[model samples]
Target: MAAANYFESKCFLFFLLASLVVDGIVAAAAVPKQQRLDRISSLPGQPPVAFSQFSGYVTVDETHGRALFYWLIEATSVAEKKPLVLWLNGGPGCSSVAYGASEEIGPFRINKTGSSLYLNKYSWNTEANILFLESPSGVGFSYTNTSSDLKDSGDNRTAQDALIFLIRWMSRFPAYKHREFYIAGESYAGHYVPQLAKKIHYYNKAHSNPIINLRGFMVGNAVTDNYYDSIGTVTYWWSHSMISDKTYKSIMKDCNFTEEKSSARCDDAVSYAINHEFGDIDQYSIYTPSCLALTNGSRQHMRVKNALLHRRVSGYDPCTENYAERYYNRPDVQKAMHANTTGIPYKWTACSDVLIKNWKDSENSMLPIYKELIAAGQRIWVFSGDTDSVVPVTATRFSLGHLNLHIKTPWYPWYSGNQVGGWTEVYEGLTFATVRGAGHEVPLYQPRRAFIIFRSFLKGEKLPKSKRISLQLSFN
Candidate 1:
């Protein structure tokens, strides 16, 4: 969770997964590469399950005096030859292992009581090697002694450092040089994923290294444009009947977006939405059902009557909560031992300002990177969960509109059952998907759907078509 920029009314805006964790200082005068190896070696292994693990530190930005701590889990089935997926969680200062691993798609799931790790039936590790990184220097267990190094945490530097880390990481594990690499993340990663991809693309071109084979990228409920994200939220609120039509119109007139202004308009609009109860606004309640419930045009699913009662007798569905305690907040883990103990920082809170500073000044954008990838014959995907008012699907759609890619496969329903929960669109070499009943954390909320989407991404396959469907322009 990136910091809450209450000034912009930007609540817990995360760039997904990138931050430097400050853990005071380690006792070792010099970072012991061997000790680093031993610490990581202590991780439990499932070799019979075909998983190989690798860990090491990489200096991502020498000028800024920054480095990264990361771990790689190789899928046993295709250890020698498989694509690599880099997963990041958006906290600005949150640990990728904490969210991406424990909460989302790593091999293990966290126990909800925040106590232990459990085997995950839907782990993404089943598909390919997954790399989880703790970036910058002050997030999670990653540490730094130089307080000066903590200053000026910006996006460009983060991207540069991430690129540096990847190059160095790949060198350590040489076999992955020729492998296909794709970046995926959610929330604030709206900035991290694209910006990092842009830098990687630039370096790949400058160095002419075929070894740095860049595939495409993925983002969930990402924040691309501040204006649309905020405005779209108001629109979401009004459409969901959360706000009055009069207030929605007033908000539209009051909120003004300008390139000259940083993100003040977005803040103002959000305040307006909250103050007015979303009157005619497009924003959805962070705690309520999504606009999908209100706008599926009678095609939506009605909950089964007495399903809850039947669940008591039949053991319906399983919902486990604390899969993260295994890696984060662990008493024995070195990272946990060095964790920040100043305040009661949630290992999994929705927001944090300490992390937000890492990217408040980032000027990097992914559209140019997207353009280059497209021209280079690489496939790309940009998706979001429709119900996330934070980084709603509307903003993502508007951002993609800038690409001007003619919708070759237009919007259509991609279903798991009789349900039409989400939508998809396929353009030349690009596939966009929206998971139904999903929130900012798409994979966690809609695991089965997320698996299908990612599986298709790994194969470079397009989503199957549905009957003629058009993108909905408005809610009502």
Candidate 2:
């Protein structure tokens, strides 16, 4: 009897081991090794770090050979448990890798000489998995087989291609399937972020079980309504003393904010604002020093062109983009990043002038979309850097005031590290905050404070309202 019992036990153990092996095999097969193939072992001049990073192209349109480039910086600790954040930089043509990753919120800061990278201690990845995508076909390392695609890119196509990229990317990195997700961007991405969110929202509704679990979105110093943005911008210039009162009045009187193109008188007035009123200062961050090294002619267009930049290649960078251009163009950097594999004709540029000049379509207003999403209970947040004259806090406030939502928490000073970081107000369906003394690129100027607000956003908590409480999180 004892021998028979022992034989049965041995058989059970054998079956258990076999089942485990089969399960492992099935799991491995289900998740592709493409993600592993795209992993970065180390970047040139990169310091040792504990986090994992992956970068490569996701082909969106096979016939056109159109692909979007993405860089995933996993969270510093317990990354799988943290939510994923998709970040975009707008110029309709800027590279997120240049602005978002290298300067604003990414893990590394390029040294002055572009020879090496140092860790960004206050990187957003500490709170969430940050995915930086260079969207449309012609931006950054992203490319297209057809030349026409670059010149013909528009708002609609940009949104559609981004959705496609995410669908395929999630499949390639199957671990991220159905993970809590959020979209965030600055400047023109006011349009991209919301439009993409709208697509994701409706797509999920159409399908029984969607792969992306999108929770909310955030935009900073965004371009919302052309009319409101224009009006508010001119007002900001005069109010902030960036332009003379005479120039301001001429712009206000002559420019029809509602029109697609400003009248000749308006253009001339605006030109005068650029040529005569403003000096050799960085218009984006009025209080900051301009990058004297990158200065050519006086920059024109305060709104949305190459002159108009969510493009962080200028202003208070201290010649940061010059360094970034050098670093990214290096052969070693490209190889390590798995970027510029095809060796496209042009060098890697921060913003593609071709796409910017010939952009096919744009939405005049995003207020309606904001209403729709807010009604659907989407968590929406808008923040501004008070020092950014380009898309100043005043411009955002004017645009958002049109929403007419009930104020949940009245405006109050929010504290970070025993100092007033900024002011914030919570609304029925949205939240608005400002960063004190920060510029167009908030993190580049005020990283620790940026982290605090970001952490609060992820947790669905309000910014700390008191210095005593702020002191607790100051060490972060």
Candidate 3:
């Protein structure tokens, strides 16, 4: 009887091992790698391209039915060997696809007529596999079945959702699972990128094998702190002759620039400075020509007029946003990308007013988070477009000063080819650069120089110093 019991136990152990192995196989098979690919045979009115493109929704929350939209563009050359970059755009609620992909760093730019696309000669995808995400639900094509999810969205929730999205995204595209990864974005992404990086860093420490091979992150014309951003913007306007000495003095006297929520007097003063003092010019890029020609004849026409005025100034396309809007709303375009599968209620927009208005949480400062990430030995780069008055280089400089990091390398002029690209300074664990002639959207204004800086950041190298120009041009 004892011998019979021992044989039965052995048989039970064998069957249990077999069951475990089969369960593993089923789990792995559940995520079919090739099936999730977007397989863009052709984009409407697009010029033929060799590289592949994919766009779809990745459901991050099953219970809440929350899904985020993404566009993945493979590298122009040697895609398999290239690193992966996840790009986000700020507004707390902006569409990375419309702004980051279409207007900024992605491979294609929407034409003025909103009927076709054009190649961005300096597309970031040429250097790495670019993935643009519309995150936190209710932004761009990303949405939630539970309406409350939109209202409840905040900084913490956004970070958590993004972390989950990255994990599941790797499952779908297993080729990039162990690939070197980087996160990048501009404006409010200063908050999103670092917060998400911190979460991933914590997860990596807790797990035996890290899922994301995260290397570092980069932000441009970013909002590091409300205090410094506000002060820096006001300072830039005054210094650049955008605001009157009287208005600047009033702002300096009445406004408490150090607080997240300013007083009523401060609000009134700022409102006066922007609406009355600054007039109709774009506050984002002070030197850029405002889009005075948009007569959309809609209720939000004025708002659109103001927003569109903020486009990159160097080769400003007044109708690009409108073009992107029209293209994204098309039935054919949606079908081709396998998007809007559930028939979302609202029309696609570059920036979601709903999400921006309903944003529940924002940090007063990202400086502390920057310190933490730097201490963790992650690569951190902050770039600013010199022409952006909204989050001016002055503000970034002020914020970095608060960190008081030891200077690893003094300020110097970084070069792109023979010409001076911008100014760069290296700190103990951070690097800062200013893109000359670039606005809030650096790539939109100076694509060649932006590409140079991006490539340098990715390769973990310093921005090339100009051989002819003296280092005296560097800012203190």
Best candidate, lDDT: 2
- lDDT by residue for model 3 (98-151), tens: 889988999888876678888998898988999999987998999999998888
Q: In candidate 1, which residue ranges exceed 4 Å CA deviation?
A: 1-50, 62-65, 259-269, 275-327, 335-352, 417-421, 465-476
Candidates arranged by lDDT, highest first: 2, 3, 1
Residue 287 alpha-carbon offset, candidate 2, angstroms:
0.7
Poorest lDDT segment (10 consecutive residues) of candidate 1: 306-315
Clashes of each: 50, 0, 0
lDDT of 1 by residue, 1-476 (tens): 23445633442233221121222234342444543442343343222344766554566655544557676777757667778988876546556766677667777665445554566676777778898877656555454455555556666767777787787777666668879898888766767787887788778778855567877788777766655555565666677666677767866775564343435554455455555563332222144333322232311110110010000000001222223433355545433333333332344322223554433464434566677778877767777776656556776777677778877877787754345647898987678898877766677667766776787788776653432221121100
Q: What is the lDDT of residue 360 in candidate 3?
A: 78
Per-residue alpha-carbon lDDT of candidate 2 for residues 36-86, written as tens digits (9 for 90 to 100): 779999999999999999999999999999999999999999999999999
Give the best candidate by TM-score: 2
TM-score of model 3 (CA atoms): 0.87
TM-score of each: 0.74, 0.93, 0.87
Error of 1 at 265 (Å): 8.7
